[model samples]
Target: MCKITSELNDLRRPSLLVDAANCGTEAYQRRRDLRRMLRVAIPPTARAALEKLLPIEADLEKRRRMGATTYSFARHVDILVALLAEARAFRAS
Candidate 1:
């Protein structure tokens, strides 16, 4: 006699389990994957905003390397904040 197993029987597989250490690592990896996907999925305008911001970020790093004054750093910080806000708003649209 031939016997067939019900589909319901296949649903009895073991539950997914994650340890504390691996959980953090897995979450970080997932975030990296999501960021990579977003980079690919961003619209042209959003990508342009990112492109514009990249040089400012690099310039900030350069200024930091050159021991820029606190005021200069603060100004750069404000510019970065505004750029970030503009990018967020553009993406929302």
Candidate 2:
């Protein structure tokens, strides 16, 4: 005899067992992906904004390379957030 399973059966177990979404690492990876996506989406006008922003990140990377203090990375991250927010706002307008 052939049998069929229902979606109701699929939901019978606790959700935590069924959910496969990676949270912590997935979130970090997704943030990186969003940043990459934004870089690809930038227009010529916005490239100026990105160019202004990239120096801070480059400085942070330089510091990391030279084994300097990590505190400065936060500022770079903040600038990236602000740049992305401005881009999103521009798009929303």
Candidate 3:
């Protein structure tokens, strides 16, 4: 998981999950600072890919609601894994 997420999780409850950012208390303010830093640090080329997570989250929620699969949450974990891989690639480059 991302460092930001790891730290944030310790400050709150269950590990932060996509579509569950609103779960823990003070989620709004707690995430604000980290988001501010990310807005500045994230590469422009990667911004589009990150933006696409929103639609994907909606899709996951839809699947969960319709009982499309028992692994919808697992898919979210996969998404983070893929993102971490890409981020590692960025560092290597």
Candidate 4:
């Protein structure tokens, strides 16, 4: 007899999806730092929600909401490295 799988569970492969909530927590903090470093105005009280929302938010909207330009966030390769590193560090468990 042969069995068929009805669901695809790619997350089972495990690069980091084990603790999504925790990763989200870190991503949230990194986003806040990114906004602050870029001088984007974010309400102190809204930090948590913003952090939680940043990853899924469209890039354009995220930039608009944060008031950051591509020049500021990604113009230089160095900045991109730092930003990406920070993001990865935060998301890493």
TM-scores of all candidate predictions against the true structure: 0.37, 0.36, 0.33, 0.22
Better of 1 and 2 by TM-score: 1
User: Model 2, range 1-93, lDDT digits (tens) per residue?
Assistant: 111112112223223322321122223332443356345544345434444444554565567557787645444455445444434444454
Tell how far residue 67 is off in model 4, in angstroms: 20
Q: What is candidate 4's lDDT per residue for 1-93, written digit by digit as tens?
A: 111111111112123322433344434454555465445554343333234333323343346446775523222222233233444544442
Report the candidate with higher lDDT, 2 versus 4: 2
| Native-referenced Cα lDDT, model 3 | 0.42
lDDT of 2 at 44: 43
Model 2 lDDT vs. the true structure?
Answer: 0.42
Model 2 poorest 10 in a row by lDDT: 1-10
Best first by lDDT, ranked: 3, 2, 1, 4
Report the Cα lDDT for residue 6, model 2: 27
lDDT of 3 by residue, 1-93 (tens): 654334323432125563343232223331342234234434344333344433454466567567785545656544443344333344455
Candidate 4 lDDT score at position 60: 36
State the weakest 10-residue window (summed lDDT) of model 1: 1-10
CA lDDT, every prediction?
0.41, 0.42, 0.42, 0.36
Candidate closer to the true structure by lDDT (higher is better), 1 or 2: 2
| Superposition-based RMSD of candidate 1 using all C-alpha atoms, in angstroms | 19.8
Q: Which stretches of candidate 1 lie over 4 Å from their true place?
A: 1-44, 69-71, 90-93
